[model samples]
Target: MLHLHILSWILAIILFFAAYQNFSDRQGPSQYFKPLHMVLRVFLLLTLISGGVVFFQTMGGGMAAQYGIKFLLGLITIGLMEMTLAKKKKKKPSRTFFYLVIFFALLTIGMGIWLPMGPISAMFN
Candidate 1:
């Protein structure tokens, strides 16, 4: 379970990079962006599943509260990212979308830092 948790975190980081790259590649003529986007979506789903498993396994009152907040933020981020992609496809990228992405990213990272000692702290410390 611990291994699964760590793997999920690592994969989440990788998916983050992949999603960013996909966004950057949107301005290019590459035929790979669509597939990459799909891959990122799949990765994000897997990350969520694994993270949920970890969450349920180690859940407590305080941690549950934190997890709920993080989960909501994550869903919001994912929705914003999807909307950004949609707007990008229409060639109408919005500054607000980018700001939302950045905001959620920072919030997620902050939540990771503030999470109780477990996989995250063990790896960082």
Candidate 2:
């Protein structure tokens, strides 16, 4: 479940950039943009679902607060990704949202790594 969540979010981030790049390079909507965006959304949903399952499975494990924080940050990062793409598509300034997405994504990923349920933890074990 943890690996699935991580993989989904990583794919989502990649797809976000790919879609954004495709959208930015063309005056009209690119053929790849919508497909990439749709796939991104799917991965984002998988991320949330997997994350939620992990969260519930690990409830009352004394690190719930930290997990909750990471979850919230992940949610914020997802929202910012959507906002950035929407604003870009409308020819609006999305630079701030783009930066926010980067910041929150990194923060969430860092927290996830630091948590004791992931690859780093497995490595030490």
Candidate 3:
């Protein structure tokens, strides 16, 4: 589950940039991007679900603080992606929204690095 969560985060980052490029070109999301967008949405859902399961399953192991922060970052990352999609759907896509997605995705990915390593584990581990 942790591996899947990490994979989802990486894939979402790729999809976010791919979708962003279509908007960057002022062409909006084309057929290619549309599918990518949907896949990204699904992966984000998976990431959230898996994160929740892992957090709850291990919560009382003395790493609640780190897990809590990671969980919050994961939620915020999903929110940023949702905002990006919403803006694009409403025909109001902006660079700022795309940038937010990129920023949060990176943060989420960074924070999630420790998840599989046991809560507060270092990134290099």
Candidate 4:
């Protein structure tokens, strides 16, 4: 389940970059942008659901607070990604949102890796 959650978010990140590239085309948003964006949303949904499952399963442990913080950061990262893309599509200023997405995504990823339940930590153990 954790692996699935990780995979989904990684795919979501890739799809985000792909969609962003399509949006940055010289001719403006490419035809692929809509489809890519929709798929990205689906992956994000999967990520959320899987994260929820993991969160609940990890309850009764002392790490609940860390998990909660990671979950909230993940949500913020997703929200920022959506805002950045939407603002870009609408020709609005989105540079701040874009940077926020990057920052939050990295922060969330660091939290995930630092957590005891993830593959990275498991490997080290």
Candidate 5:
């Protein structure tokens, strides 16, 4: 379950960057990026659900600081991604918004990798 959660989110993050790059290169998101966007959304859903499962199953009743921080950051990351995509769709892409996405993504990914001391981080540490 943890592996699924991590894999899904990592894939989602990669897709997000691809789509964001496409948006940055073009004035707006084209049909080319539409499929990627949809897939990205699906991956995001999977990520959230899996994360929830892991949280409930492993974390028990306590919400540790790392857990809360990761959860909040995950939501913020989703919001930023959606906002950036929406803005691109509306033909009013905000560079600042995308920049925020980049920042949050890097931080969230770092925390995700660093906070987990189980199998997820075992490979690295």
Candidate 6:
């Protein structure tokens, strides 16, 4: 469980950096962006799975509801990120998709803070 928590934080950090790179115009289609995007996807998936495990192991009923919401939001954010990446080389990234990623990422981070001491606690509090 502790290992999972550590991995989640590490993965989140990596994903955040990758997202920043993508947003900063430092990455592109044929360059480092694609691989970074793939890594972010894998890391996000791992984070979600580890979080689910922690939630189920510790909180069973309504306590787990928060985790479910966070998980769904994470999935939506991942989808928006995927769409953004798919549109590489376009004149501009979709502002709607970009905003969705930012919103959901912040929401997930907030939930990580507000929730109990789980894998994400280290990230926010």
Provide the overall lDDT of each model, using Cα atoms, as 2-decimal numbers.
0.66, 0.88, 0.73, 0.91, 0.80, 0.65
Q: Which pairs of residues collide in model 3?
A: none
Best model per lDDT: 4
What are the TM-scores, per candidate, against the unseen true structure? 0.72, 0.94, 0.79, 0.94, 0.81, 0.67
TM-score of 4: 0.94
How much is the lDDT of residue 107 in candidate 1?
89
CA lDDT for candidate 5: 0.80
lDDT of 3 at 7: 74
Q: Which parts of model 3 have CA positions greater than 4 angstroms off?
A: 114-125
Candidate 3: worst-modelled 10 consecutive residues by lDDT = 115-124
Write candidate 6's Cα lDDT for 1-125 as tens digits: 64775476467656645654554444444456667776777776777677667667756556677877876776776677667655544637566766777788788768866777544665776
Q: How do the candidates rank by lDDT, highest first?
A: 4, 2, 5, 3, 1, 6
Pairwise lDDT winner, candidates 4 and 5: 4
Candidate 3 lDDT tens digits, 17-42: 77656553365557787787888888
lDDT of 5 by residue, 16-36 (tens): 878866664456665668899
For candidate 2, the clash count comes to 0
Candidate 4 minimal-lDDT segment of 10 residues: 19-28
Model 6 whole-model lDDT (C-alpha atoms): 0.65
Clashes of 6: 0
Candidate 4 lDDT: 0.91
If ranked by TM-score, best first, what sequence of candidates would result? 2, 4, 5, 3, 1, 6
